[model samples]
Target: MAMRFSENADRMDVRYVAGLARIALSDAEAARLQGQLDDILAFVGELKKLDVSGVEVTDVATEAQNAWRADVPIAGLEREATLANAPLARHGQFVVPKVIE
Candidate 1:
């Protein structure tokens, strides 16, 4: 169900929202939070009254294109040179401890 807020209507129920969130709020805390939430909803109500017919919808703020480079194959390090610093090497490959039975 959609929840709406307006000056003429009853303010949002903080206790209901708290219950949905699985939170336990004391009466005093619920009252305080209710006032804060009401103010936020009122601000949103004000924003809904604004006219933005001339504004353009945009996905990004900047005009820059994708910064990715083309993928290409290149020569890699020699196996012998790479295994030189290995603690264990076998059959031109690094040997690691067995992790599973």
Candidate 2:
């Protein structure tokens, strides 16, 4: 039988999260997302119940570490060349409309 999350979902908390994320969600969307989030949490809870005493805890399966390339200074485009295509330029820099007062 499939687990029902409609009863388990916290509607208010889901709305709070949506608000914090600066997203606009309708009542229908909120209800749908609440169920989905509840379902994910329930799945994680179920996974926590599994016994893994003998299993090795690892963040990654491969032995290879993060490979990084040496940072070398390379000549880039000149200041005038970069500002040439700007819609507005001030003091040799691109000028954009102020968003925050």
Candidate 3:
């Protein structure tokens, strides 16, 4: 069953979440997104009402195995060649503009 929520409650919750996430939203945008989020939550709530007592649960959904290659050491670019592309380099390292005081 879909859960019902008040418009005021939805607006408040969505606005709070948007604020915490540092997202700027106008009143119209917040109202629109609030309705969308509410619909999603309602659908999830409906799914929770399903009877899955006989269903088997597994960690993975697919039978595919890990296709990762074996770790093997390979030749890498020389330090001189690597540093040649750096816009700024100091003491054998790339020098970036100071971001923090």
Best candidate per lDDT, number?
Answer: 1
Q: In candidate 3, which residue ranges exceed 4 Å CA deviation?
A: 1-12, 73-101
How well is each residue in 29-68 modelled by candidate 1, as lDDT tens digits? 9889999988987877786678978889789989999988
Q: How many times do residue backbones clash in model 1?
A: 0
lDDT, model 2, position 9: 50
Better of 1 and 2 by lDDT: 1
Q: Evaluate all candidate structures by whole-model CA lDDT and list the values in order.
A: 0.81, 0.76, 0.77
Q: TM-score, each model? A: 0.42, 0.50, 0.48
Regions more than 4 Å wrong, model 1: 1-10, 52-101
lDDT of 2: 0.76
Model 2 RMSD vs true structure: 8.5
Model 2 regions lying over 4 Å from their true place: 1-12, 73-101
Q: lDDT per residue, candidate 2, 60-84, as tens digits?
A: 9789998888899889999989989
